[model samples]
Target: MATPPKIPGLGAFADHKSGTPRPATPRFVTAAAWFLCLAAVMQFIASVFAIMHSVSPERRAVLEAQHAAMTGNRPSLEALQNIDVITVVLSALVTAGAYALFSIFLVKGRSWARLGAGILVALTFIQLVGVSYPEGFTTLAQVVCGVLAIALCYLPESSKFFATVKSSRS
Candidate 1:
């Protein structure tokens, strides 16, 4: 068998104990990457549904009624429903798309990607919380994914992957 190519820094699969020039990509980061990607896919699906239903009169009526109930003030269907399509598209493109893009660099143990993911995950949780309480399984799923992504990235098991060699060695 041919020998594997050696990279100068952050090469493949360097165990935590090894004195390699670069730290290995830990399992936690790997898991977090998958989780973030999954979140993005799910968010995209949600956006598509929002857009598809947005033009339906029944859907518009239901949303308007729900809004009025939550806000304790009646609002016209045109006022409430007009924004749904644009809102969902913007959220998908910006929020979910950014998460998907950042996850690529995140796997390489980039600190900025890690920090961005953290902030994105936090924003996801905040958005989830804004939803009405006593939510169903779908809302729970969003919260769980966000929390899990944060935990996987920051927990000690995977933290070494992002640390500088000098710090991890000390």
Candidate 2:
């Protein structure tokens, strides 16, 4: 089999086929991974805050008043709230899990992990709109970390690193 041509300035990373030691993870990728981990933690905290805020006495009172004013129905409103809580819990767990899993694979130089993280970041941004203040703050922090992670993962150094990993795998 013909050896692949060495990419300029990436010879060290691309030479894995020759059994030389693999290049150290790039700083950009490392930073991206840490940012992803931070995002995951922040997402979980934000979810908890959201759940607390949603079930607070004050919020319950407001919801009750709204329901009473609209349809004079309590049972339906209670059911709706329960569904909302369950949805939020499930969404939070899935999102945080994806962020954590992708971060681990990203550190190990999996090219697909970055793409998955980027998609999650986009979804997080959409989910954060119109959140209540307490949870909003945590969500905002998570968004910042997620944005930074995605940005870092697309940087030139990170791109090269992923490319090297992909080529080595082939």
* Top candidate, metric TM-score: 2
Model 1 misplaced regions, further than 4 Å: 1-21, 62-83, 130-139, 165-170
Q: Estimate every model's Cα lDDT from 0 to 1.
A: 0.70, 0.82
Quote the lDDT for 94 in model 2.
92
Q: Against the hidden true structure, what lDDT does model 2 obtain? A: 0.82
Which residue segments of model 2 deviate by more than 4 Å? 1-22, 62-78
Tens-digit lDDT track for model 1 on 32-128? 8888888787677666666777778888778867876775566677766768777878978997778787677667676667778888877776766
Residue-by-residue lDDT tens digits, candidate 2, 1-170: 99978566554223345444445789999999999999999988987887787787887888788778775445777775787689779988999999999898788788788989998988888977777675588788888999999899999998998887766665
55, model 1: CA deviation in Å? Answer: 2.4
